[model samples]
Target: MSTTTSNHIGRKISRIRELRGMKQETLAEAMGISQQSISQIEQSETVEDEKLEKVAEALGVTKEGIKNFSEEAVFNIIGNTVTNNDNAAFFNNYPTFNPLEKLMEAVEENKKLYERLLKAEQEKNTYLEKLLSK
Candidate 1:
């Protein structure tokens, strides 16, 4: 493989990792490697295929997907879809749900449920004490 292609692949890996909100230390922990090793991998122009496969798995992307990744292409696609307001095309092309947002919403709803349950328990305890005193 050309040096340029290898360099691009390494850079792509780094970019995708950052976009996924992953720190080098976090990725290292996930892959059972050292943070320095993760840093070195990010800086490398070429990685062995086995190592590359492990990195891709840690980052939650396919090996081929990482090899072919392009930030500019992603931005262009998003720009076109958002600026054009062609909702149908955009929906058909990419996933609409944000997993993080959904998780946060679920957590908030659970918090509310917990609070209600606590209030009911307190009221029940108070009623039981009144009955016992009588």
Candidate 2:
């Protein structure tokens, strides 16, 4: 039996981040760091545990997930899911949602929520001002 080697943690993080449709800039913003720092972190072979945890949070994955990620394995799973009719019932029930698309949808929903909150706050302040004027 052949043993499989794990990819470098940094490389795995980078690949997962990309697959999740997250830009380095967005990750940096979430982590309170610069985009350049994100780039440097991705190039490093290893990252400190604390920083890795923060990166995992920003990328919406567990640290363990990033550590164990395998691009080839993921693609192989996707390929099999697409080609196998045996699993059609499951796929039909679940609809084979793409992770990247889900991430994008989540981000959009967050933006809308933020905008609505801002608008509500503004309206509340305006009402308060009118009450104060009387």
Report the C-alpha lDDT of model 1 over 1-134, residue by residue, as the tens digit: 32334446677788889989999999999999999998888887777899999999999999988888777767777787675565565556655899899999999999999999999999999999999999
lDDT of 2 by residue, 1-134 (tens): 21124557777877888888999999899999999999999988889999999999999889888887877788788877676557575546644789899999999999999999999999999999999999
> In model 1, which runs have C-alpha deviations exceeding 4 angstroms?
1-7, 84-134
In model 1, what are the clashing residue pairs, if there are any? Answer: none
Instruction: Report lDDT (Cα) of residue 95, candidate 2.
Output: 46
* Candidate 2 deviant stretches above 4 angstroms: 1-6, 84-134
Model 1 score (lDDT): 0.84
RMSD, one per candidate, in order: 9.5, 15.2
Angstrom error at residue 2, model 2:
17
Prediction-by-prediction clash tally: 0, 0
Query: Native-vs-model 2 lDDT?
Result: 0.84
Error of 1 at 57 (Å): 0.6
